[model samples]
Target: MSAKFLQILLIAMAATFSGCRNNSGDAHEGESHEGHNHEAEAKSEAKADPHAGHNHGEAPKFQYTAYSNSHELFAEADAFIAGKKAAILSHFSILPGFKAVEEGKITAILTVNGQESRAELSAPTRKGIYLFEITPSTAGKGSLRFVISEKGGNTESGTGEKGELRKRGNYEVIVSEVTVFADDHAPYHALQPEPSAVNTTVFTKEQSWKIDFATALPAQEPFGEIIKTSALVTSSQEGEAIVSAKSAGIVIFSAGVVTEGMSVSAGQTIASISGGMADNNPAIRFEEARNNFEKASADFERAKLLSADNIISQKEFTDTKNRYDNAKSVYDNLRGNFSRSGQSVKSPLGGFIRQLFVSNGAYVEAGTPLMVVSQSRKLTLTASLPQRYLPVLATVREASIKANSQSPALSLGELKGRVLSYGKAANSDNFLIPFTMQIENNGSFIPGSFVEVYLKGLSGTNVITVPVKALMEEQGLFYVWVQITPELFEKREVKVGRNDGRSAEILSGLQATERVVTAGAVQIKLAQATGTLDAHSGHVH
Candidate 1:
């Protein structure tokens, strides 16, 4: 009872002084009185001291997070008290893209003691934020909600896709429960504030909307065994044609310079053979054939009439007709083809020039190969697989192909592709077995270019997977950004199983419903280096 009694008395006196200072400004002028309840004040101080982590200058704040088909709402408001004014801060963000809502009407409704009060804001003080002030007339447990409406009905419900949400009208966003106390001196007046997450990175809607940012939910998809290998893109079996010289002569390209990869059409003259003063000179040969055809025609006409009138023998008419037919055949063949130049070399098929066998002005013999034109509409993707894969080659039914290292892998099925053939055994020259797939070009693939291919088997199992772009690497460990809230993202380390050059199978460390950053993941990783941000930075209360 010696030192302890003195310490207790001093602490009680100090608490009394602090309470008097807090209520000094609330009293009327000259209305001071003496009989105060020190025990009640001490009990209130003890309850409030445990929540000193959060600022409680005047009143406590309550936070609620909610989501709608169209938008996400995160709201914070002052604790409800009878006849006291409350300030509410609401943040709105659009879904799918998670961009801030630039324009809208946000209504905050508070229902307490069988009565309702509302505060409305037509526009935001800042983008994505709306502040509301309301007063509660009575105090009790109540429900609070927000109704959002926008003009022109342009707001999307989900993904902005058709049938995802109501084509027109406003919607409500559901949030956490609401509690109203009788007064500030209630039993549950104060509580410890939530600690900020260390690993959660904040990517603001303003920052995300400006860049190429997007997110997608992880999904369980059918994934098959992948045999990764290199492939060669080549023309299909009937997609290539070789143009040959019909007659031997000096080659002259038609009009402009002809080069490899130049587009050509069937019967289109790509070059001409000039028989300058030679035996194959089409100019001289054409004239001779014309003269011979004129003589043969006159003789055949007279022979036909004479044989019918019994003026000539049947054998003579037959001989005349044969000569006429032979002369006409040569004339007709050279008629359209012959000119000042020897003969026109025409492409047999419409395609790009894959190869030019002979240069301009080069002499070539009859039937000499001139060029190769490929109708690249259909292409063959050939992959060389080791002998061990031969056993599973027959089970392979589809392929995923990347035209180049920078391109995303395209599905063979989507390209109207199918397995053409596969070698049962490895060839003697090279020990690797060849596997070929026929895929429609879709104007995306180039012939003779090497590509990365993933040969997929017929059997598969459903597994969680994400696009390969979503995964980031750190010291050989793969990680992806998983969005916990609209703006808060947590980096999760995952064990990658199989990658088909497009989507990767996540063996662990992820949930199917969690949305992951499919694009602009690097931006978030860079933000992590900068440091974490207070998610509630712009709060008004």
Candidate 2:
């Protein structure tokens, strides 16, 4: 090849090698870009926090020493000693309400037992307590869990022998009533929205027991009043006597027969039947004999007259007269019921016919069932009451009944029942002790319909009551949620009372005025169950 041609080939080969290297470099750069993007994403995710809300970030805590006994309460209107508090309360501190230090001196004034006792006032402590115990003053172990600074911040607190009021940091508290318990292990572990306020649940029975949940409201906060639902009742009835058919057989037709419940006059035939008609009414023979006897009787009468007039012998007259007597007897018996097969049986009383067993042109035999006669103008609702309610029934002075046929059974109803009879045999349906309620039905009540009853007997003074839905239960423990913040719900325990079967009674842990979770209680719990929320895990004073 020529020298010039050789040089041109070399140049072309060099250019091709350079092109291959550039392509390889471009491919590697694409993969490197993906790796860089992935690394950036990972960094962003790691910097974020899941538990951001609970990051109390070295929040000040106070220690609690004194407390109220945490005993359980049972039975209605039970009271607890004022000083007893729950052991769950861990610390007590006078967490500085406020020290108006005009020029830098702890110029705070703490009045103990109505006297100016010295205050070891200091900064807010780092402790958590169930409650606070007042100094051993004539206040009689009085407990104050919070204090207020002239400013506006609130301080959480507990019971103590002598409170050490502080001077610095956030502060404000208005201690109110303290909870007392009967048994330490009461189901008082109810959930609440705020840790400060304790609320209780009323699982069953009206006002059976009380849970002592002191509120943080001003010492003299007025309690919300209570009210009772109407009375309890059963089915509506017309008359006292409830009757049923005793025999069973094929029904027979009557002139004006109808099914059960068709009203008819007293004389109107409720039911009827021509029994044994297929066998040829035996009474037919008696009727024919009766006719023959009638003819013989006529002949005998004429013969008797002849005998008297000497036209016939005495023996003949006597024989004819005897034959007339026999025939007459037979005819008289047959005349009363010559054709028993077609004889009509009538009712004896005057009332509406309630039930019938026969139809026209129908045949029945002996002992066949006819129809039932009901004396009841109305009906009564008989209920099988549970034995657990025995005591409640007796103590009740009055009761009312409601029809259970409501769209969704509830406290509202047409309460129009009264007490009729009580202490009957067991009910046929539930087999519970029977309680008869004579419901004067003006036709509003049907005999076979079911109903529900609400009985309000003894009542206490009116107090604020919360809806049962506002309450929450977990692991046998009951509680409520306070709408502390728009999106946050604090879990707290409460004690409750009488159940209207609609709303639950609040005994303690909640204030009547405090707004609670009307719905979505479970949702709040699920959020808390993850320990994402301190829930009841942390301590409360």
Candidate 3:
């Protein structure tokens, strides 16, 4: 073949090779496009997964606590995952009453990157627990607020108008520092660590509602120095009276029975003095006065006749008239007071008979003491303190008195009382300084009864205190039940300082913000003895 023919053949072969390369590239491109479609389908299937974030494990529970004027909200929610459904559980409690919220509407609003989403529950699943589910729209940092609509929806006029159902009140609890993670693979840490279960007691809301249960935060207040002592309850000067005999005779009780503590009214006849064989007898005096009056009348009549005949001087007639007048007056006075039963003795004031000085049918002389009456509306507390505490007595500002060991201490301020005086020198009998306080009786104080007294001094310092009832004595140490959450309480040993009957000072083992069980502590103690405390009550699940 010629050289030109060979060149043409080479070119044809090169052109064919180039066409083959192009066909191979087209086939490879088709495979690549198909692989891309497969990847796209895989991604779409992953997005449709119902349990994408939850596949690893259950989400960590996030808890938030908030308070409103009407209610307290404790909320728990499963950590958020973007484009995934999560569960939220809310516990609502009424405030000031601390009862479970039986009925209400709760709404959870979630906001992320200026986008907002909400989930609402018409009513609580349980009495106070409202459980619901929410889905986060996007993955980023977000915030949540729980809006609660109290039961008994109010109207525009706040009077429950027909067909106008506005919520009675909407209480909002904001959850801060909330995050929506892209996936569940990342480590999560809760905002607040869960409280430990050790030394904790579970007092359920149901149990608390069934009985008298109450809680109060430790009060930061000025606490005064305390001086503890015993006191005697006695009737005040204005609250007591002495009943005396108006005449000398035998004592006779009225129809109504007279005894100690028997109530009497002012001007009510309680007893009578009858004539006896004694010299001061009313019957004897009456007879004497009658005889003397007869003699005086006889003399006065004879003198009057003589004076009419001008047989007597003017002075002698005047003397005779005066004697007759005196005799008549004496006779009339004896007759007025001397009855068949003799003289009646009436109570000078309204009160109860405190002491009977004489017995019925007993002989008594004139102006003799019979009985003692007490109004009992007011009382005086007299206490004796050691001479060493004289400085404290001078600084006393107020006092608290307890009638008995089982009774609670009564504050002088609350009883409308005041310190009357403090003794300047020690008494000879007890070698102690005397102190007196006047208090309104309130029917609890009994005269002559011994009581516990706590004199509060003026020197005070700011400290935290709780009601005296909050303390429970174990062996000798003082313990208090501190509330960790709404239902969880831990028995904490507190260092007790001065206590003024009603309140106790906490030197340690307590915080001002923490709450304590003021009432029903004994019930908890009994429950503790019975092992009724649930150890796992702190777990949200």
Candidate 2 structure quality by residue, lDDT tens digits, 1-541: 6999999999999999999999988877846554467677766776794333433333222222222221111111112222332122222223121111121111122233344222223332222122222222122222333332223234323322124433333333322333333332322331123344233221111111122122111122122222232223322333222222222222334544355655545454334333344344534555567678978889898997898899989999888888888888877765553234444444444444454555555555554545555545445655566666655555454443444444322332333434555564556676666555554454444456665554555554555566556777778878877654322356778887655544556667877556566545665565555544332333233
Clashes of each: 0, 86, 0
Every candidate's CA RMSD = 8.8, 25.7, 14.5
Compare the candidates by TM-score and give the number of the best one: 1
**TM-score of structure candidate 2:** 0.31
Where model 1 places Cα greater than 4 Å from the true spot, the runs are 1-196, 276-285, 288-333, 349-351, 413-416, 440-444, 538-541
Best of the two (1, 2) by lDDT: 1
Better of 1 and 2 by TM-score: 1
lDDT of each: 0.81, 0.43, 0.81
TM-score of 3: 0.66
Each prediction's TM-score against the native?
A: 0.69, 0.31, 0.66
lDDT of predicted model 2: 0.43
Better of 1 and 3 by TM-score: 1
List, residue by residue over 74-166, the lDDT tens digit for candidate 3: 666787888888887777766555567787788889999988879998888877778778889898887888887776555332221122333
Error of 2 at 79 (Å): 47
By TM-score, the candidates rank as 1, 3, 2
